[model samples]
Structures are given as structure tokens and as C-alpha cells.
Target: MASTSTSATSKDSPEPSPDVRVWLGNRQAVEEVTDHERLAAMTDTELAQQGEPKVRRAIPMKKACTFLNIPGGTPLLEGVGTVVKAWPHMSDASAPAWVASTSGAYASLLAEHFGGVEVREPEDPDVMHGPYTTDTAAVAGETKGKG
Candidate 1:
């Protein structure tokens, strides 16, 4: 006579059999992911060739000397860090507004030519200022009020 016995499995015993259908289903559901490390590993030449990321268009450097009415022959590298007063957007040519900046001369020129407003960048004083929202309204109002 054949006899059947049930015994407890050992701690090191193999796990029960897995369902092939579930395993296959899971395999099909698994998704592949590419991350930053994989992206960074790519070479610059490869990146440029592949055109993965968009390249930003560069803006032309604003020249302070030209705005300052300085001659081209004058050596003014020292002025890069110095605060120069400028009014980049003053509509009135004779009565142009003014502000302080590293590129004051340029700002002033812009004011005389374009008539925007005075800009003062205390942190980076070379920046153009004024064209401020309130300033625009005030300036336009002033112009209209005068007329």
C-alpha cells in the first residue's frame, strides 16, 4: 500500500514554485528607465551631434564705453567694476533721467537715445534701470501733462 506523509520544510528549503504566467506577465509589465547619470555619461561631442538639449542663443554684450561717449581708443577695463551713472530710457533728449551703475555711461546713452528710464542695480550697479512700471506711467503722464 502506498502511503502519503506531510512534513514541515527546513529553514533553508527552496521556496514554492512560481507561476510562469504571472512571471511572464510581470516581465511584460516591467518598464525601462533612463536617468540623469546615463544622460551625463554622454560625451559633449555626442551631445552636440545628437542635439539632445537645446542650445541658448547668446545676447550681444552691452558696451558701456560706447554709451559713455568714450572714444574707442580709450582703455577703460577699469570701469567694468565701477558704478557709472546712466539713464537708458529717457524720452526727452535734453532732460534725460539718470541712475547709478557700473555701466553708467551706457545706461545714460540709452536714456538719451531710447528714453526708457534710469536703472540702478545696487548689487550689480552696471545694470540698466528705470523702465520701471511706475516710472513708465509717471513719465508718460508727465509728457501728457506737459502737453
Candidate 2:
């Protein structure tokens, strides 16, 4: 009778090492990775020599909005000025606000509209007061807010 053994290592062959797959455009290759340090030390050329084309993943707007902590479809206030200075509890403890508008009339209008007082100077000099909304009627082929 004859005896036989099943083994990965044979007298004529050696064992294979672990490898990592990387991507370079349309080509694919395999690379033997000794360890994480060696893999991290590999150059772009070396990585590309043994990599496959990578697939990109896209995130939906709803998922992205959830991740960003902002509600979807919220219009950004473009022309709103940043708070250069804040006067909190100057007159009343309950009312706290910032001096953001430069124009006195505009500031008065804003105060009347939003129930806030207008200050002589903005806490921030860089902030400006203006009408910032786009004319949707004009965009839709109607003459609105376009004089």
C-alpha cells in the first residue's frame, strides 16, 4: 500500500504571502503586503501597479442633510450680515440681540419687522444690509422687482 499527504507546501513549491488590492484607472494588479507599515510606505506607482479600478459611492441628499444636521430644502439667507457686536440685557434681560445692520433706516425697518433695536455702529464692520432675495417672477419671465 502507498501513503499520500495533502499539504499546501510541497517539495517543488513554496507558500504564498498575503496581498492587498489597489486600483489605478482601468487596470488591476495584486501586491504582496507584509504588514500595515509596509503597505502604508508603498508609493502611488507601486500601489497602481497592482490595483483594480475603484468604484465611487454617492450619498443621497436626504442622507447627506441628516448627516450635516441641517434640514433639506432650507433656503440660505445670502445677504444676512454676521454679528459684529451683540447687546444682550442692555435694556431688558429678556431681549438679547446683535447689532448687524449699517443703514439706520434699514436697521429701523429690520427692528420693526423682527422686534429688535438698531444700534449706531455694527459690532462687525464687514456686515452689510441689503435686499438679498432673487426675483423669482423675473426668473419665470415676469417683470417683478426689476425696474
Q: lDDT of all predictions, in order shown? A: 0.27, 0.24
Which has the greatest lDDT? Answer: 1
Worst 10 residues of 1 by lDDT: 19-28
Q: How close is each model in CA RMSD to the real structure?
A: 33.5, 31.8
TM-score of each: 0.18, 0.19
Give candidate 1 misplaced runs (Cα > 4 Å): 1-101, 122-147
- For residues 1-147, what per-residue lDDT tens digits would candidate 2 score against the true structure? 111121123456554311111000101111222355555777889778965333222222211100001111111221111110111101112322332322343344334434564333443332222111111121111122211
Mind giving the per-residue lDDT tens digits that candidate 1 earns over 32-133?
Answer: 223456567789898778745322221232222112222222223322111122211222123223333233443344344434555443343332331221
Model 1, residue 64: displacement in angstroms? 19
Model 1 local distance difference test score:
0.27
The backbone clash count of each candidate, in order, is 22, 7
Clashes of 1: 22
